[model samples]
Target: MKITVDRDACISSGICALDAPTLFDQDDEGVVLLRTDRPAAEDEQLARDAALACPASVITVTEVE
Candidate 1:
């Protein structure tokens, strides 16, 4: 699986950071930023949680096309 983030819509709510700190962090402007491209499979759940936590729906996850 792959994870992506859309910066324009991000508001840096820190939900993603709270949900998946290893995969995301709150930037100075308070936006979710991916720290790594390929996170562990075990962290996938947290990543998904983070994605869902975004009010702006800027996070994207894809396992296939």
Candidate 2:
């Protein structure tokens, strides 16, 4: 899967980090930072959860063939 974060739409709620620390993080300014856009198979669920947990709905996960 491929993860994308809309920096302008991020509210800095940190939900993504809470749901998947390994895949997401916050920048010094508290913006969402993508640790890995291409997550491993094992982390797919967490990545999805993080995207859903985002209150701003800025996180997007796209299936990669």
Candidate 3:
């Protein structure tokens, strides 16, 4: 799966990082950071859940293929 995040739309929420630490992270200023655009198959669900848990709704998860 592919994961994308809109930093401009992020609200410093750490939900993404908390939910999917391997796929997402927060900068020192709390902006959303993309750890990897393409996540492993095992992490697909984590990415999806992080997307759903994001309060700012900035995280987007999509199928790579």
Candidate 4:
């Protein structure tokens, strides 16, 4: 899966980091930090979960064909 984050829209909720540490993280200011845009197959679910869990809806997950 491919993941993307809107830094401008992030609210520093850290939900993405909390849900998927490998795919996401929080910066020093608590902004959403994308650890990887492309996640491994095993981490597909985690990426999706992080996107869905983002309170500001800043995280986006796209299925790779």
Candidate 5:
């Protein structure tokens, strides 16, 4: 699975960090940053939860399979 973050829609809610700190973080401007390598399969469910929890709907989770 691959994760895409819509920076424009992100409001720095930090939900992603809460769900998948290994895959997402906030920049100095409080914008969500996507890991270049994306999230691993083990973290797919949490990542999707984080994305869905985002009030801005900025996180997009795509399944490669």
Candidate 6:
């Protein structure tokens, strides 16, 4: 799966980081930083949850064939 974050739309709520710390993090300015756009199979669920937990709806999780 591929995770995509729209930095412009991020509200810095930190939900992504909280939901998937291994796959997401915050910058010094509190902006969402993607630790890995392409997550491993085991981490895909957490990545999706993080995407869903974003209040700003800026996180996107796409399934790659």
| Candidate 1: tens digits of C-alpha lDDT, residues 1-65 | 68899988897778888888899887788977888766788988887887788888988877643
Error of 6 at 53 (Å): 0.8
Q: Please give the CA lDDT of all the candidate structures.
A: 0.82, 0.91, 0.89, 0.85, 0.83, 0.90
User: Higher TM-score: candidate 4 or 6?
Assistant: 6
lDDT value, residue 52 of candidate 5: 82
lDDT of 2 at 2: 96
Full ranking by lDDT: 2, 6, 3, 4, 5, 1
How do the predictions measure up, each by TM-score? 0.87, 0.94, 0.94, 0.92, 0.87, 0.94
Write one digit per residue (lDDT tens) for candidate 4, span 1-65. Answer: 77888999899988778788888888899998888899989999888777777788998888878
lDDT by residue for model 3 (22-44), tens? 99888999999998999888988
RMSD of 3: 0.8
Best by lDDT: 2
Candidate 2 least-lDDT 10 residues: 47-56
Candidates 2 and 5, the one with greater lDDT: 2
Backbone clashes in model 5, listed as residue pairs = none
RMSD of each: 1.6, 0.7, 0.8, 0.8, 1.3, 0.7
Q: Model 4, stretches more than 4 Å misplaced?
A: none
- Model 1 ranges off by over 4 Å: none
